[model samples]
Target chain A: MSLHLQPVRVATSSDDSESQLVFAEGFLVAMLVHLSEQHEDDAGRWFLEAGFGRIPSRDHPTFLDLDEAQTWIRQQLGNAYVS
Target chain B: MASNFTHPLFPLIRKLDSIATLTDEERQAVENLPVRIRALRARHEIVRHGEKASQCCLILEGWACRSKVISEGKRQIFSFHIAGDIPDLQSLHIPLMDHDLCTLTQATVAFIPHEAVRDLTMRFPSIAAVFWRDTLVDAAIFREWMISMGRRTAFDHLAHLFCELYLKQQAVGLAGEHRCPLPITQGDLADATSLSNVHVNRVLKEMRGKGLITLRSNTLVIEAWDELIRAAEFDATYLHLQKRAVP
Candidate 1:
């Protein structure tokens, strides 16, 4: 009936990996490049063909490890915020 | 109590064994936390929603799944709990569960009370860090799985899940290169992958058809592991489970 909204950092609940760090800063540009070119077409479908679904292939850009993924995410934030 | 923890996650927890040099009493104190054990059959709810956050259940054996119930009776599974996984570790702060914790197979779990954990962390600050890292890793997994379910195709999710399990089980000394036994069903996977059961079945047949893996019984024999790993794009950095074997 009512809501239990608290102060929790809500990440993206969409089929887009770019949701993880969207609001922080220049990630907007990276995500724009990410969502438009790669995920909008068949490159995204390859993951479905493989059986795993829901990863925004385009946003990731590369199949990097988690550490590297985090690094790239931080860089996106730092570059965007610093500039 | 015997100090040699024969639990499967011992290797994983042992990796956080920076307190090995503690005195005998301290070692015993850390190792002697009251552990409540529970065994569950397939497709059981180990813990349900709306219940107060209580003891953290450390998964000792078998497979389990954590999911959230959405509209239209659909379930979105966050992670599969295998040997050595503390499925309820995230209960540290959340007052009540926002999702359901269920078992997908006959499982063994040890209930470590929150107070005990808090007290233990008080004595050993690194325990908190280790567990904080553990929960952070769990959050990382949720993020990755969410990425797959939100963006990738069905096949990549399956491949990624298999690679994930193989590596996760291996960290706990439960798996090897060629064959890894996972007690999972297609319906369970369908809930996990956010796909229809029929779709999961069709794609599994395709994966087998393409010689990526061989599924017989409940176990999986990865005939071409490198191919499967590549297909899933699996990397082991997330696991962070490299325990120096005992001397």
Candidate 2:
């Protein structure tokens, strides 16, 4: 059977303002998050390692908060998921 | 008689012969059909969506695909065509194009008028039956694709596509020995398979690691045909090739 993305609940840390929205499908887990400044470098490295690229001059959009990150994830998923 | 290769309907004749035999008179009629040949560059649009087509585009050389651009400029490719294939043959009856037909490589195309096609079909019932059968087979392929998208895994879908394409090219004498020309990009494959480019690359890597197939320099070589077929659960019944290869 084909793998399909299923959205999991959004999680937020009490000590930090950083938010993560997780999506799961079979053995794959995709995490979309509003990266804090300390985590930006690590996130960029991870994105590059994941083939998303991390060229400094590249115009990759950065979301400042959870709502923007959630919207971006939704847009990427398109009609692949229900609700 | 001079060489049949010199005939205007050579590609069409070869195509029909792969599906059904034609009488001498029917062959003559096809040779006499009016056509305007055009050479197009890769990515050139032969016909656009919402356009009322007056002629059908027949691929004499190179490849073409029918696709639709959806939201976010994401294009979904429906079918690929090669020599002896009419990418827009449905336009003869439908009149209006609901999707775009474009070249995937530098291509030689013959534009046959719908009026002429209609006249030919009316005069030759046997030839008309062949064309009808061709369209029916096209529908069958579409159904198979829908099944692939709805039920098959990405690896299975890619394997199935490779199997189908190889058989198609082999039927037309363009491929043999489990190898075929695959002049399409990872992105193109992604569009056709409804997967992302990254995912396609990953799947291809997995296939390579499994020793199932090798795709390089626009050529795909099936290293283990039986294994690839098994992975895909592929059956060529829907393809309807007259001279089907035993797998």
Candidate 3:
């Protein structure tokens, strides 16, 4: 479902916030949310909107780095490039 | 009128602008085509993974499903293609298809040859943008589906999908008053949400018991909008139609 326009989307310093997360279109929002909540510092700080009514975090698994994280994210999004 | 497919789905292509660009006499030169129409029974496979795609399949009738399978046979459905959808336009570029498309209801479709579609696009550039943007919107819809299937819960997933299909079909004048044609079965719903059939059935019952939604005879009537939207945690930004209004 997630198709990249560039080879890899480089996250700029400007993009290092919850507000810019709005620009992260489509399934990318879901991917970043996983990375942000699980990876903590590596992912980015979360912006909680009282609107989103989930348990926030349930499985307290150790978070992954960027490269490894993107793989898991892409898998969740159902990439044709991967299995 | 030989051509009447001018709708909001055609991006960057103005309907009135097209009138001056192409004359009715010249437009008439290309045949409107009497195409062969076929019917697909509910839940029947119209196209499967690895099948050679040759025709431009247009969903002229009921709702249909498109999905892909993952490792350990985990299935993830991309999105539903309703009327006016050419579900496989991107398949032309990829050569081999990696997913399956099936009818969720007793559906009817018009098949146009690939070559004819290319010719048709060349002949009608305005309509071409419409189809291309339709494909772009199709990709956007997949992005939303990916979110629901991968992250959202069973009830949330169903609610988000219901909201999405209702809005999309409404745009085309196919849906009305929170009532929409949804022929998807509980099993099919499970496949889309990445949940078990029992889970899907239970979720449906829960929603119905809460009086949030109702499903009977292939039609879904959403009785509570705010409750359903809150359950799904869905926002409509991904569809990207807002770019048209920024001026």
Candidate 4:
């Protein structure tokens, strides 16, 4: 199943507020925040702000773009469903 | 005796003196203790987990840390040590190291034999008491860390750590005027505080934005010490430094 990403703003209490809400089969699966300029080298990267349903909180990962994030999210969701 | 008192092992005396009063004889005994000195490169492991250690490492210069690695290379740093700290003092009694101890920066360290330490303690009960007191304070610091990990927000937890680091240095005359060396990298802070690197970066920026502190060139200057302490609700009482360093 393909993932749907809805562009949104997150109040992360920091400069990195631009975010996206991901949906898998109409169920919200994760939220990703865009790293702000304050992050220096990591700026412009997308960070997994939160993940639900077998996507552990400990895996706070950063991706190069939304495409990579969605792909990773799909993998996580796919693993969750298979297992 | 004065010339001998100016020994390389003087940092140990200073460290112990920071916690409790050391009589002349006690100080002399420590100064006279034989130590094999070595200059270690940054990140060099001094004692590995499960290794039976025959000696303890004392930090003569720079910094070190006690840490353990779990599955997938995730490291949890238990404590950051500075000059005068015996990072593996427990190894004197325990022999087997439970966590790995390593230098955080290029460091000068003195290795003190366990036999000598045990003999010294056996002869000087007061020195032994001070050592016991040191371990107790170490446990107290751990309790604070537990609170930060379980309850405090990332911002508060980091603030508390900064305060602790500054005061610890100040007590030993290594720091003053709300300023201290912060040579540790952001990644190290993440491991110590149980936060992600991204999270640590954000908190540090927030701290900078709010004018709480300025970390530059491996130095941390607490610009708003009062406000920071208030925000973190830091109580120095837990540190139990007998001669509390003037902040």
Task: Candidate 3: list runs displaced more than 4 Å.
Answer: A1-83, B1-31, B69-74, B240-247
- In model 4, which runs have C-alpha deviations exceeding 4 angstroms? B1-6, B244-247
Question: Mind giving the per-residue lDDT tens digits that candidate 1 earns over B121-158?
Answer: 78876566666877777877878888788877788888
Best by DockQ: 4
Pairs of residues at least 3 apart in sequence or in different chains that clash in candidate 3: B10-B130
Q: What is the TM-score of chain A alone in each candidate?
A: 0.25, 0.36, 0.29, 0.90
CAPRI grade of model 1: incorrect
lDDT on C-alpha atoms for all candidate structures = 0.63, 0.76, 0.60, 0.89
- List model 4 lDDT by residue over B1-247, tens digit each: 4663468987888888777677788787888788999999999999999999999898999999999999879999999999888889998889898999999999999999999999889978888887887888899999999999999999999999999999999988899999999999999999999998889998998999999999999999999999999999999999987663221
Interface RMSD for every prediction, one decimal?
13.1, 12.7, 16.3, 1.0
TM-score of 4: 0.95
**Best candidate per lDDT, number?**
4
* Predicted candidate 2 versus true structure: per-residue lDDT over B55-77, tens digit per residue: 98889889999999987687999
Candidate 1, which segments miss by more than 4 Å at Cα? A1-83, B1-27, B242-247
Provide the clashing-pair count of each candidate structure. 29, 0, 1, 0
**Which residue pairs in candidate 2 have backbone atoms (N, alpha carbon, C) closer than 3 angstroms, thus clashing?**
none
